[model samples]
Target: MYTISDYLLDLLNYLNVKDVLGVPGDYNLSFLDHITRRSDMKWRGNMNELNAAYMADGYARQNGMAVLVTTFGVGELSAVNGLSGSQAEKVPVLEIVGTPTLAAQYDQKLIHHSLGDGNFEHFQNVHKELGFKVEAITKDDAISEINQVVKYVYENKQPGYLALPVDLTEMPVNPIFKQLIPSLFRNKNEPHDHLQNIEAISNQLKNSHHPILIIGEDVQRFHLQDVVRNFIINNDIPFADMIESKGIIDETLPQFIGTYNGSLSKDLTNQLINKSDLILLLGAILTDANTGGFTQSFNSQNTIDINAKRINFYSKIINYNEQNGFVNLIKIISQTSLSQSFPKGPHDSINNKLPVPSDKPITQDFYTSAMSNFIQSDDTVIAEQGTSLFALEQIKFPANVKFICQPLWSSIGFSFPATLGSQLANPKRRNVLSIGEGSLLMTIQEMGFAVKYDLKPIIFVIDNHGYSVERVIHGMHEPYNDVPALNYSLIPEAFGAKKNQYNYFDVRTEKELLMAMKSIENNSSQLSIVRVSMAASDAPEDLKEFGKIIAKQNKG
Candidate 1:
């Protein structure tokens, strides 16, 4: 005789959710108590609802799935942005919002968070834009609704929304639910055209002369990295990933080449991908930001784009119902007689050689080189939007390193709180965050959450004095783009960091930056912060080109 909340927690446990990220509110306090009672699940409280959603996203990206709890109206609305981003990225997250009691909603009572019109269904419609599955749980259908939404999230790799009334939080549910949820585990809606699709793809590859594999965010979101890696290595195929899929494959692998970002890619990368006779795009999303503002020149007729449930060959759309999905397709293709060799990708013959350290001050070029050498294997890189996102793209990541950034959504303040969630998800791996001062200020309160949880992610704050990316876009010297310079090194103390618990460094020169890196190496336990100061107008080379494209697009 478990309560609905307990049943929900158990369902989440079956989905591998070890922790729930959320902020507390009066409506959700009852549900929070149940979260406290569950021995297998822990509640990670955040300072705000948006941060909670980002934390849940990071957790889901690492742990397969994540649940986030928030209150009705205000709380749920604040979390909508994060949930939408997860949907755009095709990550699986369950957003559970605690609402007023059933009676209050029935009577249409005016609530504190409502718009005074007594309409409670507005937010429900709003969240529908995020994913296909959404359920407003009731006393009668609590178990079934929770089960359905969770199953849909797992099957589809998209976020799900559930609004639980306060009255139903601890209400006991049917004992049959325990057995039902476990039984439904085997009932996922898998693709059903595995054999035929694999044969088709194999035949196509056999006919092609130059074939290349392009991976994207879907591979990571669907947890097919190992299978995809095996396929690439066994087939001896040259492969590349989109900007958002950094580190999906080990960059150190011989067949693994540089990232392909349409025109923004290196000359060699563009030449290899653009001139190829056949392109097998696996779960790749060709967004404007990742494709250099729609400058990609690949012919759709020659591309075989494979998504979760559908395959696109040229202009034809084939919906394949495959039970094993891309895994089986890859397995069959591995044994096929496709050519095992192709022209070397751009990774070789590319000069990533760093120039001599400039004596003047820290620049984006030097920073990228410093970071390339500083990052090690098993490190998760959390990159904030704007300059931090585009700048870090040039760095060479070590094996097993993950690069997390919101390039498509371009949401600021995401990486700051995301560090908290990713660290908690993978506690053994070191988390390194690169964020600008403007972006950091948006969710700086989450720094306290990191301190409270004893998370030691190395944070790099690029102190450019303002929104450098914005300046590049339109207002180069406009005062509207400028922001005040605040001392970032002292923020740890303000966030309640104990004496030995944290270390801070402010660097304006290459010498100072290297010294800070050495100090961080020596003091590994402390949460270290290294502030890199740079010119206000300067930005990464790719970022500069992107801004120009965006500015032109806006004008048109």
Candidate 2:
């Protein structure tokens, strides 16, 4: 009596996907039933699809591939922001779409959020355009397609698809279905025992007067923490990260520098890295946000880029290179007889480090420091776009802890829903959310999902009115820049949270915030929202300059 729904559960279980973030509807009810009836997979309900997708992304970033399930039309459209972001950031995601039965899909009748002109292929089209491998399911193809879709997305580190046909839910299982196994493919970047480019890199590291290493999420994606740390410690190379990639090394290491996410080594760090004769980059993408649009004083000296694909050392820009496995290069670098005496920052004697909190209004450095102390060693941090990004850049976490954000897309509304995934993935791990007020309102309904699961997190709502980041960039000081905000504390009530279980803290003054934060230590685990207030005058110092540049570029 086993059906496609049962096989689907088995597929999810095989991927170790115990949690799914999504909304259930008529089209997807059979799948939902399977989730409810089965013991292997657990469901974290969401009020909308966007939140579901984001939660899935957050969970995937931490635990593994996240399962995001949704119904057709409105449900599919609702999740576009998060799914597209996962695609942009190279997160492996398993997105399951529940389509109308094979017959009603192209009906000319007006349906909500559907491309009613009979283009039922819109969902698949959107997925393809966004770089996700899509599969439109028919009753006949259900077994084979589901198996293949899961395998491709799992191994490729990309978003993938499964468009389910409702009719397949009730179809009788065939004995031949057991033969549908996942297809395996090997990566071109696989490592070997020895490599020439790696040997050259080893030589460079050995000869260099000062060499620093930069890494990003790619290290985590490739699971090279041990290799990265060993290389750094063995070579005595100073290292820094691009916000989300912090904590790859033991922060206690003397050579471990603070974040370079937006700071861009500007005053001291820029000079240190740029002035270096040799720089080894391990799994860093060097995006505009991390390098401040690559305007690190316009250095002409070549940087050695050692990513998963290639290894290259250069006098200026990319020079001698090999497009092979960085793992092998790292191994070669680790064994090399490199000098251990690397130069330190000129300001190493100074107290200038990542911003520690003060008894003042919220600043990125201060906020992150406080948050770092607030969360336990294993707590998960789910971040959204804007000033929160700056805060995440400042706090250092343990190697096992994770910070999830939709950086590639940098979309709002992710932090709120992503918490659902984090909670579902590891029930014991504390989940904390960092999001701006504008971002929270985008998918505020997802808060109900939190209450439903009783998944508690201290959600810090950075309440600075509307679109703070955009305002900082554009300098559009008009009424349009402000958002219509409600009482931030009332959100929990509106989201169906019970009074006894919900906690609200409005932090306007420093003293109040300190008190609220202290109270958090006593609450075992509660979904508390601490609203942080900011003045219009407050912004990142570099952000003001960015706004001026935008104004100058627009000048007539």
Q: How many residue pairs clash in each candidate?
A: 7, 5
* lDDT (C-alpha, whole model) for all candidates: 0.83, 0.70
Compose the digit string of candidate 2's lDDT tens values, residues 1-556.
8787787777677767888778887888887887888777777677778877888887887776888889887788778777888877777888888887777765655565567676678778887888788887666676778777877677656788788877777676765554443323334654464465656667777777777777777677756788778877776788776655756665547776655644434456666766677666777766666666445432325467765544445633332233334444565566766646877653231222434335677664455556666655676777787777655655556545667766557787777777777777777887778888888888887777778888888888888777777887774577777878788777788878889887889887666666788887788577788898866556555545544544565673
lDDT of 2 at 243: 57
TM-score of each model, paired residue for residue: 0.95, 0.86
Judge candidate 1 at residue 119 and give its lDDT. Answer: 83
RMSD of each: 2.1, 4.1
Put down candidate 1 lDDT per residue, 358-399, tens digits, no spaces.
Answer: 566998878887887778899999898888888777565789
Cα error, residue 295 of model 1, in Å, equals 1.3
The pairs that clash in candidate 2 are 55-418, 265-270, 302-315, 302-316, 302-317
In model 2, the Cα lDDT at residue 118 comes to 65
**Candidate 1 regions with alpha-carbon error over 4 angstroms:** 187-191, 321-337, 346-358
lDDT of 1 at 117: 84
What does the lDDT read for residue 87 in candidate 2? 78
Off by over 4 Å in 2: 103-114, 138-144, 171-194, 262-266, 297-301, 308-340, 345-369, 372-376, 396-401, 545-556
